[model samples]
Every structure is written in C-alpha cells, then in structure tokens.
Target: MNTYYYYDDKFLLTLYAYLKQTESSIVRGLSDKWEPASIYLEKHSLTHKLIDTLNSNKINPNEKFDNIFYKAYLRVKGKQFITSNEADNIYILLKAINEAIYYKKPQIYILGFLRKEIIKTSNKIRTRISCKKRKLLADNVEHYNQHYNGKFYTIEQIVNGL
Candidate 1:
C-alpha cells in the first residue's frame, strides 16, 4: 500500500511547486489565466472557439476525480506541505485527469491546460523526488468507473461544485 508506487519524480517535483505556490484549492491550481475554467463555465463549452469546437456535455468527467482533488485539497488546507500519501493521491488525481481526458469525446484541451498548471506552478520547485511509476489508470472508462464508482460530473457541472 505504498503510494510511492503511483507517482513519478517529475510529478512530485511539480506537486512540490504546487504546494509552495498556491494558497488555495487544487481546482485553482489546475486553472489558467490564459485558459480559465470560468470562461468555459460561462460559455458552457470545453474547447476554445479558436480550436476545434466541442461542448461540455460530451466531456463527462468521473466523480472519482472529485475524490482525488478532495484528498489533495485536505493535504494543503493550511500548511504548504505534503505527506507521501498526500503526494500519491495528488498524483493519482493527475493520472485520472489524463484518463478522463482520454475517455471523453473529441479530446479535452482544458485538462491539458490543467496539467500544464502543475509544471508551471512548480517553476520554483527545483527539488526532486524520484520513484518508479508502477501503475496507470484503469484500461477503460467503464471499467475504471465501475471500480472507482466516482460521482458523475461533466466538465461544466464540475466547475461550480468542486
């Protein structure tokens, strides 16, 4: 049950940056001033008008995503620090976000936007934590959802609640 099995060094370093830079929730950590979630929420779409157009309805992220964020959120609620378990959970959520992006239709650019936030925020985090990535997200969305049974929230729906 070691969380070290899940996250790789790059993610850990970025997560370290995430802890130092942000004083708020993981949701904010995942957003961008360039590609804000609020704009997507207001527009009720997932893709930028400049890029290929897609709606949020086609991109339903699993509820398990919320669980991962909640765990990461708890770790950083007060102190700008992270435990091994906390780090693992945050990394898992990032993997799940990648999975969520893959599972949804037309490929979500926003999730990539969020992923970039991790590395971007971690610019100051020059420290490193190395580990082997022993696992990946479940093979498919249905299997992953059945195993995790996370609450169902589409991209736009998730914006307000989480």
Candidate 2:
C-alpha cells in the first residue's frame, strides 16, 4: 500500500533543515504549511475579518500580512492545532511526520514523541500513522533494548546497520 504521512507545517521545516545540514533521506510534501493558510484565507471568517480590518486600516503590508497569519494561527492555537504556531512546534511535527512517511514507502514507519491520548483520538488514515505514544515500545521494548544515550542513532549507524 502507498502510505502518506500528514503533519503540520513546523515539523516539515525542521526536517527540511535537518536534511539540509546532513543527509538527504527525508523528502517532504508541500501540504504542511500553506494548506492551513489557504484554509484560513478561504474558509475562516476570522481570517477574513483580520484581512479586511488590516486592509481597511492601511497597516503596513508586511505587518498586516503577519497579523493576518498570526490571528489565523491563533485561531487554532493550544488545541491539537500544532501545539503552538511557533516555528519550532510546526517544524517538529512536520519533521516527525516526514520521517515517518518519507518517500512513498510501501510500509510507512512513524517515529517520534507521539503521545498516546492523541492516537486514541484519531480515527482515519491519520490514526493509522499516529501511535499511541510509544505503544510499540510498550508492546516490545525488548526489541529496542539498546539505547544510544537516550539519543537518536546517527545516520551513519542507521546506514551501516541497514
């Protein structure tokens, strides 16, 4: 089966940065960042109001744009909507999802600090991708007995082992 991993914007950017700094294993989709922005612009009345208010007030173009995005982001803040619209939060989420769904791999593997409660809440293709936190670990921690000082294994190690 072809697998697709969907994540919020921030995580994707971090994964992009990581790929830039190191290896080129991860390839991400364009869906993360602007998807929400498009939705905000097209559907959300609040976003429309923000844009209208900004344009009507003749706010500086850059500041007006920023405020519109900020308000749109705030509209989904603190909820499961990427934790926070901060670059870090979006980056982390996208990175994890990108890693999980890297390429069009037949069997997708999601790895990250995914929380259990959130998994239970999912009920779709997304649910398939999300884990019950680390239920895999709980189910078979023995398989992952070795730890690299509580850190991610280096790319070299993964390459060598594979």
Candidate 3:
C-alpha cells in the first residue's frame, strides 16, 4: 500500500535542518522521497498558501505566527489523520526522521525521544483547539470509554455509542 506523508511547518523546518547537516545514505534516501511530496504540497495546499501569505506580510504582522501556523497545521493534520489508515507509513517516516536527528546528535538518549517529541508537538498544536471544542472532545472520549468498558473506539463506534 502507498503511504502518504504529512509535513507540518515544524517538521519541514526540522527536515530542512537535517538535510543540511546529514550525509547519511538513509537520510539522503528519505530526503529524495520527500522532495516530490514537498513540491506537491507547496503547489497545492491551502495551508502552504496561508504560510506564504503570512511570510509575505500579507497577513497582519502583529498577529502571532504560531497561532496561525498551528491552526493551519491542525486542519491539515486532522484531515489527514481522519482519512488515512496507513499508520505504518507514518511510523516509518517518523522513524527515519527521528533516526536522522539521533544520528546528528548522538549524545541525546534515543529511546522514546521521538514518541515524546510527537506528544509534545501534538499537545502544542492541540492547544489551538478552543476550550469548548476540547471539552466536547474530552466528553466524547469519556463517553466512548465508558460505553466500551475502556476499550478503544473508532469514530464509527463512537457515533454508534452516542
């Protein structure tokens, strides 16, 4: 199965830094694969356009870039997460990126580092979700958990439970 890669601005920046600093064959191969996806995303994504607009000062300069970027990033990430079933592909890409980072900085503890980073980045992005939305999501998860006796529930299962 073909796997789609999702690249948020933070990931892109990290990747760019990695590409600039790394000479590893594994990293180079991943970069080569990523280049086409990056081009396609740049040409087609509304999020990319928003980023360009923000960068060009078309948007209010006083407005927080993190807020705007996170909103766009979440929209893209949410849509991709909801629609895609290729979690293994995401894991593979993430592993490559994490490996590249580890190879660059060998001193840092590698175990669970990528997982922690993923959680941290996700929490940062998720903070952009309004309190009301967050509450609703929490409620939904709570409801689902109760209904399913703590077993994980898919969206379909959640809807059915409701």
Candidate 4:
C-alpha cells in the first residue's frame, strides 16, 4: 500500500539545515530555543489556533517567517501526521531544496526520515485495525502475533537505520 509520511516543522528545519550544510552548533541552538516555546504553547491551549493562523494567507506571504512559525507550531503540537496544508508547505520546501544552487548531502537522508515516519504510522494503523479484528480463536491469535510481530521487527530495523 502507498503510505503518506508527515514532516513536522522541526524535522523540516533540521533537514533544511542539513541540506544547506549549516553548522551543528546553530542547529543545536535552534533545537534548544524551541524547547521553551514548545512548552509555553503546550501549557496554553493555542497550538491549534497558532497553526491555523500560520497557514493562513496573512502569514503565508512571508514564506521564511511562515516556515519558522510552522516549525515552532509543529514543535508544540507534536502530532505525527501532517494536515493537508502542512503537506503542501512541505512540498514547496522540498521543491526549493531540489532547486538550490549547491549540492551537499544526498537528499536520501530526508527521504530516509520520511520512510521511517511512514513505517511508524503504518504500524500504528495496522495495530489499531488488527486490535479491532482480534478474536478468541487460536488462529486469530496466531495471525495477529505473526502479522504485528513481523511488522514491528521491520519497524525496529528501519528506526535503527534512521
């Protein structure tokens, strides 16, 4: 099956920095700076509203600022899947990355991260669906164990590679 992977703002920023060959210190600083903002956003109930506003036209005109806010917004919201708007934003970023003048690390690193996320999300959905189909029969138990156990093992390998 085709799976969709969501890249939150933080991951996108990190990927952007990585692609741009940004200094590790600056990347670390970005992560450190986001922590408190994330905490404050979580403590208050404004994460969703903030995300909505960031995606709105008023903010969208300034792509750089919009991306920054989007990263902060994702750091706060902490959801695994991207909304449709977020997906569109990410697509734009990916295109920008592709057209950049300089070549650094292969883009596969970002693709690898995307693959890992897709695997994680698919495993979660599989678990939920299997749980609903679970039955008392030994055959059902065997099927459940076999399917999910194998899936998790593959997920573990992918995560470790990531």
TM-score of each: 0.22, 0.20, 0.25, 0.22
State the lDDT of candidate 4 residue by residue for 3-114, as single tens digits: 2234333333222222222122113323454344223323322223323433553334434434656645544654333445444554454443332212333354453453
Task: Please identify which of the two predictions, 3 or 4, would achieve the higher lDDT against the true structure.
Answer: 3
Whole-model Cα lDDT of every candidate shown, in order: 0.32, 0.28, 0.34, 0.32
Better of 2 and 4 by lDDT: 4
Q: Candidate 4, residue 18: CA error in Å?
A: 5.7
In candidate 1 the C-alpha lDDT for residue 57 amounts to 15
lDDT of 3 by residue, 27-118 (tens): 33243443443333233223333234323442233233346565467566453111123333333434544443434333223323433444
- TM-score of model 2 relative to the true fold? 0.20
Which runs in model 3 stand beyond 4 Å of their true positions?
1-111, 134-148, 155-162
Q: Clashes in each model (backbone N, CA, C under 3 Å)?
A: 2, 8, 0, 0
Q: What is the lDDT for 17 in model 1?
A: 28
Q: What does candidate 1 score on TM?
A: 0.22
Tell me, by TM-score, which candidate is best: 3
Candidate 1 residue-wise lDDT, 63-111, digit = tens:
3334666546534442223335544444454454434333423233654
lDDT by residue for model 2 over 1-162, one digit each (tens)?
321122322222222222221111221112233233223222211223322432333332333324546545544442112222332333343344343332333222232132221132222212222233322222211111223364343323322331
Q: lDDT of candidate 4 vs native?
A: 0.32
lDDT of 2 at 154: 32
Global Cα RMSD, each model: 17.3, 19.3, 16.2, 18.9
lDDT of 3: 0.34
